[model samples]
Target: MSYMEENLEKYADPEMYDHLHEGYEVDLKTILKWAKQDGPIVELACGTGRLTIPMAQKGFRMIKMDIK
Candidate 1:
């Protein structure tokens, strides 16, 4: 089986993942601080776009990717 097939259970519930990750902003400040505002940022394994959406709102061009 492929990687995604094997990991189906892990990525099955997006809502659960979001709930678990909600209010977790430990990395946001650092990421914004280091990342250039005028940017085309590529975020691999960007599950549920938690960071991608915020960055895009801040005017960053986001290329988000995930298997599911």
Candidate 2:
């Protein structure tokens, strides 16, 4: 199978993906620190909005996109 197909099969279940990636906050701090606070931010491959939600709560207008 192609790499894309393999990846899709591997991450088909959102719940399982989330569970597997839980407690993954290594990039949160860096993103928050560098991201502009005044307005919109676009996050590519934003899986289930894990980081997007928190940034939104912090008053950022988040634009999220994911392949799922």
Best TM-score among the predictions, by candidate number: 2
lDDT of 1 at 40: 90
Report every candidate's CA lDDT: 0.87, 0.87
**Which ranges in model 2 have alpha carbons more than 4 Å from their true place?**
none
What TM-score would every model get versus the actual structure? 0.81, 0.85
* Residue pairs with clashing backbones, model 1: none
Task: Give the poorly placed runs of model 1, Cα more than 4 Å off.
Answer: 1-8
User: How many collisions per candidate?
Assistant: 0, 0
lDDT by residue (1-68, candidate 1, tens digit) is 89868877766799998998898877877899999867599999899998999889988999999886
- C-alpha lDDT (0 to 100) for residue 27 of candidate 2: 94
